[model samples]
Target: MKKILKYTLASLIAISLANCTSDFEDINTDPNGISNESLTQMNNHIGGSFTPMFLNVFNVTPAWNFQLQQNLLGDVYSGYMTPPTPFAGNVNNMTYSLVDGWNGFPWSDAYGSVMPFALDIKNAVALGGDASGEKFVHLANIIRVTAMHRVSDIYGPIRYTKFDDFETTGEYDSQSEAYQAFFTELGTAIDELKAFEDDAQFAPFDMSSLGGDIAMWRKFANSLRLRLAMRVVKVDPALASAEGEKSLSSDAGFLEATDMYINTGFAHPLTVISGSWGDVRMGAEMESILEGFDDGRKEVYFNPAEDPALAGAYKGIRMGIEIEAKGQYGAHSSIGSVVDSETMQWMSAAEVYFLRAEAALRGWSNAGTAQEHYENGVRASFGQHGVSGVDAYLADNVSTPNDFVDALNATNDIAYPSDVTIAYNTSGTNEEQLEQIITQKWIAMFPDGQEAWSEFRRTGYPRIFPVVVNNSGGTIDTDVQIRRINFVENEVNTNGDNVAIAVGYLNGPDNGGTRLWWDIDGSNF
Candidate 1:
């Protein structure tokens, strides 16, 4: 991990130098004239550092990087999408073979692209001693929490709190510890930014849909706090309640009207992956629920299958099935035009509503009611996608997910897991009501498989079908599903001792089967 940190900084410095080499040659004719202070004026150093951090959160460039960073992992695991192509002759992530080479992207992308830039901003601000600049650090902290939390969720323990210390940079914090830090940092950022709520310094560096509005960033932070708070309700109910209530009471408010999206200034990666490369397609679970409910957003989320046999119906492939070649499923649904823009969605207004819905279901303070929040989540999603017929869609309680049928292979088909309905179940049990909320949340949070996957592991709702094939060699259970990706090979090779200790923090072995600190077994309630 020390090497990892060094490489991160070295890479950042290389990029910085590469961008300014001509300026350096011209300005540094007299070496003494070019001081570190002088270089600060060369560009908006502090503000410029933020671009990579924001972009790397989802890794928008070079499509394949995004493919590994998220698509192959969270997107598939959440049952939102699957790749039609089978690399390694089908013994890949979908089959639970655990591709170490491919799995390292999530880790490397964060450490390489996100963490160093954030730390650079923090250090640059502190060294400058500008009280006005302190706001930048707070903002960076919020983004850090936003990006690193996903990394932490992917791998149980990560080097987070003490990452700045070179000597102990390799030491790992358990997921619980890292999550606690996330809450603390988010709370501090939210509170401190109140004084700078009207400050426009962040505007220039703002790549998100909020347009550098400090108040909106505070809302995003507060909403993020709410999300992390809800994540731990089952494991640490008291702390979860305290933090959740704090977020609810904050004047910064929650993401209600507009969703948070980062303008990466590149074509949406899914356009390439699903459209050009023919790699990814819609998942079976999406077809079951969306089609069964007669969801208006179904067309918004996916294109109809081009296979002439399916007669242009919206179709998706079941994951982890035997695939001799991509052609068998290549004509299935590709991604819809919703992601045809340059922006990558971070958090949806609908997701925040669904989080509130879960908080209400858990009987947290200030949470109005589960049904209200649940329905609002649906409406928000409907509005987000320009879908109509919400009233009729919400009234139909009899509709449940349709059983899946593989267009090419009967062996890959399965029954829809539950009788959960489109309408909120007021008379249902706590677990049943939770299923309804999470199922809706799952539907609403399309393409954001990272959060969706985490929610699925936490609450066990919207029951995903078991894989059609198991290839974990008994290390992972087909019924239990893949818990977390194995610790990356780079960590194992470069930071062996620390990685060993990190594995000890897991509930089981250091494999895809092991549950993280929050992924406890049994009832969500």
Candidate 2:
């Protein structure tokens, strides 16, 4: 990207971090209390960098940024949501036009807010003695990996594993290289963090739902490792299985029973985007599966349809369709109050269970039976949402994904392609079992569309609706759909050479048609 813009953004982030200085007014006679400068002087700068990174990843402010970075693109693409507004005369992302203006937010936000902060933390902690500050370094590494992996998932290649070197900072790592770095970083963090299991240095800087519990952070890190390992199972099964078994057997265990979340002081952006502004509503796939299973979590996930024509029913819009204005489908089911709450889910325990379920299907050691893990995943999700009747739902073997209907366009409708049910079929083939695991995992991971989108690209479970319009100018196939986002315009303008090299890493032209390194095209099973 532009060096000047990057430098300017870093300066702004430093100023923001300065404002987060801790209040120091204990027995110290200096009543003026510790100034921001003193906080940095006292080695508190390392922890200070974390607040901005955590808060900005799933950006808590200027709700429109979140709309562009995640809600509009991943949310729609993953079949979790669709927008009502006909942005730019309905030829936007919902219609597969790939809006250049909006597509840059995820990249810009990562490099501008998250990566810079993470770098500052690593640098600050590294300045201290290696043995003394190892814990802080590990913590920073964990946070860095957590934030950057999402960026790598968005656009195939990203500035990672080389961000610290000025000469190579602007260069990109291919998605596979980035994933390897993530594994390395997580491994380092997990190994070093175990040495400081009793340490509370992170507690003061902790703003996440983990609440400064270093052990819980370890659990989160291991769970993240498992999630990433599973992503590569199809592309590199041996490595995937090895990493998966390591995570499952780690002393710092997976995110079992409780998931990871961040309690940003502000209301979730979805509350504002989907509830207040009505810019987004439920996607048709969500409506089909949730309504089909008669899942009790539907009430927790969405409000009743507001359109008078479909009164009291849960309804959603198709991805790409002609719309004159937001008022057209704005009255459809609004996002439920669950997302509008105080915290944003980072990873769900339900997802961890499903990941283990897949590992079990692959016959990985310590993963338990697939059926047991699958049932636990569903039950865990129900408990997470405070929905009752899990036993009844798990026992019902007949419910299948209902056929999706577009009330506005008949051609947009499609039949339910799979007969996978909520109950586990012990005698089912590996492919059948895998689909069942992923489909529910898809449901359990609702509203966190980025992960869901990545898994969908990897496995093709819980079949999502194809866009009704092909606005890609023939770059992206209507059936295959958009695989990866093209590198943003900012990179083209300033880092043109590096962006071109990054395109070389892609399997096809630098467009939505190109698949990422881990996104194999054939059956995962």
Candidate 3:
């Protein structure tokens, strides 16, 4: 990582134009575009490429794009939220009918924004010098894994390892293969960064809350390794243990007291979409689960519904109902003030504790007792939300997720499927313990529906409610629900050959019905 002085996009062009004064009129090319001098500017180096990649992963502007990229798909499917408006006549993603146009954002946004910038950083560094560029390349690798894993989780297969060259630029790797690549990349990054632990090259470009500390970045990489390792525990137990233990054994600590959030200089997308625009509302499951647990954080997570008929209680809407218009559910609980802050969450410390809890239940080395981790996870979440009384809440042990009742439409309501309680059940079976850990994790990771949705597909815990309507045109089963989004239509149109090969990598049809590689649709025990 080279220390490059930050320059504005305008200044870079100004300098290039100032230098080319003699030949400026002869060459009628825009100097602001990727001109030789513009590309060679100090700001265009390894550090420069990161801002674009970081910002794009959780895109800030064009709120509608963020809505499609995450809110509508993962957020709704994970049982964390439900859209108030009846999109496409109530036959859209909420109803299991895949929307080609809406489903394309996550794919297009990643490739169009995050992926290309990551590749540019790698290329820009490699073309300069190997020794000097190695650190930058490793940093780029960490960012790549962070962004691409979500993309792979969405579509089952993605162009990752083979994205370097023109000949194989359009190639795709199956989810399993991509996970392996991610582990390998993390391993390399952790190892290399340890040697350069005192390096200050990363300071100039640091936008993370960690402030470009190499040691902290090393810890982040290790923590990420643990996360990915646990993601595959069900599908490949041995590999999961090996990778997970490596993380536990490392001196680079996991994210414990602090979380990973970037200061993006904008309001959280959820605030704009839910609070300002009134497009999203609380999910019925949220209302049921929080009320059942008597969770105090609910006050911070959601606002009291405006529907006077409900007497100012927190209410949520169910997915896939006959919504005539947005106004029908506009008065329902919109996202609360917690999301109005000006930062985007990449990961949470509470989530790490829950992950450790699951790893402990699996009898992994260095994970500590399952009960301890589970309680800590709850405490971390409570602290994160500035709520007190965690000890009393954790001790009750009597509360269970309440049966969901949709006041708007009782026909769509469902009873609580499981009786799992909050207190740590030390004598319970492995399956019971796993469910407790996952369910707590699901709650702590509110608003981050991508990871929650992936966990739901893999573990089948916490019992997410199924959609009331099945509108997949005989392609998706309502019980299993939508597993993963189909390959983006843009890829199919421009890269048909690769898309065909990618579809073959899927376990089932290349639609929302298909599960990804790590999402084994069976018992973990």
Candidate 4:
């Protein structure tokens, strides 16, 4: 990684631009006499790249609990969608946050960090450098995609090609274009990695330091390809389906074990319990999910809601009522339980397996029997997570659904510690097996991204609940949940015309309640 040169260049720019603008100088200069060593410069840059990956961990906590967590719990986000909004609002609450319809406040750790360093890494590869060069390009590409998705998914447009240029203001590409670019970027990187084809090894880069090793980098790249493909399911099925299939068919590896995942080992302050984000309780939906499936992972996902103050007066928030009145409606529901302790979930291989299962089920190229992929996904999840014995799981009612309808319904069912997977129960129909597969997949990714929500939306397999008790939103959801977030406030100001076009086409009349391109139909697209 050639870093000192970039800083020197920036400093030179700062010296020249000081007369024109103090702000430019501020961005380009430090004045602090920090060590000017090349290794130090590289470390500074790498440390900065950590945000895309770290912030992603935060984005999903709210989403996992908000989008996937509560939906599985009982179909409510903190209830920003409902009449009397929950204290923690939906899509609106995330600072400068939007799902897919608007603009966002843009920051550029990835631009300054991941992008330049990656360019260096790519250049090194081109020069026939060692495994470290290949590793850097592969991991940097994965990191780049991660950051791009977060920005593009939220704001609907971003600067991809000219992103890192300090001199240029940068052009905003449409979300469709950005998604396509990501597919190209990651796919090309994958090919380059294979082209490098190095057997030599070196000291592994810290997941905290960079991303990981060459093999892990390949797995991470493939896994990300799966995620990005899934993202466009509503917008471009043909493309999304093809991307999904390629990962499944290709020997590109995925994170299947806990150890194999991009484990950050992030310090406690960043954990769900104590991080700046606050201890994310196991959202009520997640709790319900665990209870419904009779899944044992609840123990791993959360601790019992502790009102441990022996002198308690209900000071602690009730488990599932974070967003008060709004949760009464469908799609306006419970979230993951907030635990007393802090926790951090980087990534998991089980996630990759489940993602693969989805690709296979959709009948992608080189995809295997859905049944086999689904089962392997289940076993791999169980095996990686440390749950044991299929015997106890088979006996459970909710977790082991007897038929397809029963299994789909089981997703909304509160999972219990005793609930286990018993796919061996051949007595059940094939669809029933899919229910078990998706339901478990939902459970596996509890603390990570919104796969469960996407799976539920796409498959509609694990039947969940409607907001039957109270009509908070008052909209009356007939079939299933709403898709996509309303774009953030800034879009109207910064990119008004383009934002309007997307909202008009994508959101329809009721913008917030609208669906994205992939979520064509709720009954499992």
Clashes of each: 0, 0, 0, 48
Off by more than 4 A, model 2: 1-43
For TM-score, the strongest prediction is 1
Candidate 4 off by > 4 Å: 1-135, 154-171, 195-205, 208-211, 230-237, 258-280, 306-346, 394-433, 461-480, 495-498, 501-510
Runs off by more than 4 Å, candidate 3: 1-44
| Superior candidate under lDDT, 1 versus 2 | 1
Pairing residues by index, what is the TM-score of model 3?
0.91
- The residue-by-residue lDDT of candidate 2 on 15-105, one tens digit each, is 7445642332221335335444544443566666778788877887888999999997888999999998898988888777899899999
Q: Which ten residues in a row have the lowest lDDT in candidate 3?
A: 1-10
* Candidate 4 Cα deviation (angstroms), residue 243: 2.5
Candidate 2 at 363: error in angstroms? Answer: 1.1
| Runs of candidate 1 exceeding 4 Å displacement | 1-43
Every candidate's lDDT: 0.88, 0.84, 0.82, 0.47
Worst 10 residues of 1 by lDDT: 20-29
Give the worst 10-residue stretch by lDDT in candidate 4: 310-319
lDDT by residue (tens digit), candidate 4, 93-164? 221122332112222333434445444444434333223335455556666776666545533455566444
Q: Model 2: clashing residue pairs?
A: none
Task: List model 1 lDDT by residue over 1-525, tens digit each.
Answer: 577766665666667656643354544455445555545443367778899898999999999999999999999999999888988999999999999999999999888878887777776655444566788889989989999999988988998998876667778999999999999999999999999988887788899999989899999999999999988888898999999999988999999998999999999999999999999999999999999889999999999999998899999998899999989899999999888999999899999999999899888888889899999999999999999999999999899999999998888889997988988888999999999899999999998998899999998878888887889999989999988998989889988999999998888899998888988888987
Across residues 1-525, which tens digit of lDDT does each residue of candidate 3 receive? 001111222244345345423343322354333345533353345566788777877777778888989999888888888989888888899988889999888887887667666766665544443354578778878888888898888888998887665557688898899999999999989988888788877787877877778888888888899999988988899999999999989888888888888788877889889978899999988888888888898898899999998798888887877788888888999898778787888888999999888888888999998899999999999999999999998998799988988767778788979888899999999899999899889999988888889889889977888777888887888888788899888778777888899999998888888778998877887
Query: Total clashes, candidate 2?
Result: 0
**Residue 253 of model 3, lDDT score:** 82
State how far residue 505 of model 2 sits from its true place (Å): 0.9
